[model samples]
Target: MPSCQPLNRMKKVLTAQAEAEKIRRIGEAEAGSIEAIGKAEAEKMRLKAEAYQHYGEAAKTALVLEALPKIAGKVAAPLAQTSEIVILSRDGSRVTGEVNRLLAELPVSVNALTGVDLMKIPFLQKMTNPQA
Candidate 1:
């Protein structure tokens, strides 16, 4: 009866220890999840702030410039699949003209995407600053 009493106490102690460890691990997991959520929220706010900072025609132009490569790639993608390209005009004017025609749509595309026209964006005056 004395040995049984000691064994019961030991079993109770081990169970309590296991419960404590389980609670500690749960707390750590919750803390990590909270921290991760906070970081994501902060990143979202930072991006919104950055966007606010760039709210102008110049910024719009810069954005258009950045997207130009992607736009060009998309516009020219069909040509990529062509096994061979044949030039009908010996002077290559046909190809150049076609490219120019494609590029002419860029301003309209930019306006559609950004709600602003790139061509209408005022350029900085150098030689003719009337204030100067």
Candidate 2:
């Protein structure tokens, strides 16, 4: 053989260089994909916010009414997952009281979160004071 050693070394160097180039290309493709996904998500959020801004008070009230049950479901989800609830007191009334308090707090929490006073709404006002 003329010089098989030099040929083998050169082949190894070429293979390593090709692998490095492939890795760099893959990294750049992944970065581009990530950037595109981020931009898409940002655009979606912007459009959603714009749509929300277009909603009238009546639509917003309807939206809140629809959301109330979902919010209650979320609040009650933890209890659903639990096998049993332990009451430290002699009677289980404490637990019932707490549950009642949580239900009572929902409207206050919703008002604080949405800036819509649930009490002032005409529908709720009529429901609360039906004679009026």
Candidate 3:
């Protein structure tokens, strides 16, 4: 019976050691997955940063140009909801022309807000003035 007790104790010790080794392996695997995820995220950010650096102001201008109509729509959204409007003017005035003028002013507004002068962009300059 005394010898049997020692064998049982040995078996318990081996079981505990096996459990500890399993836990260590799981911890190491979890750490490796976390490291891989971190590396992938870092790589994604690095690529994005490089792309932004490469695109530079051209991307900004394109984004602004793309967004201009949306911005104008937002600015004029309240007016769109109006059922009717009465304007009294001594001179002949057209609301349509006023709306067009307001839309035209968006680039200037964008320039003021973002400090990215749409007029300065070569493509925009070419668009505005073909001779220049």
User: Which candidate ranks first by lDDT, i.e. highest?
Assistant: 2
Local lDDT at 68 for model 2: 81
Q: Write the per-residue lDDT of candidate 3 for residues 8-55, one digit (tens) a residue.
A: 999999999999999999999999999999999999999988887788
**All candidates in order of lDDT, best leading:** 2, 3, 1
Clashing pairs in 3: none
Q: Sort by TM-score, best first: what order?
A: 2, 3, 1
- Residue 124 CA error for candidate 2 (Å)? 2.0
Lowest summed lDDT across 10 adjacent residues in model 2 is found at: 123-132
Please give, for residues 1-132, the per-residue lDDT of candidate 2 as tens digits: 497999999999999999999999999999999999999999999998999899988788888888888987998899998998766887789889988898667668899988777877877778767875
For residues 1-132, what per-residue lDDT tens digits would candidate 1 score against the true structure? 357988899999999999999999999999999999999999999998899676876776777778878987998899998999766777788889899887677677877877766666445232224343
Q: Per-candidate TM vs. native?
A: 0.46, 0.75, 0.48
List the pairs of residues colliding in candidate 1. none
The total of clashing pairs for model 3 equals 0
**Clash count list over all predictions:** 0, 0, 0
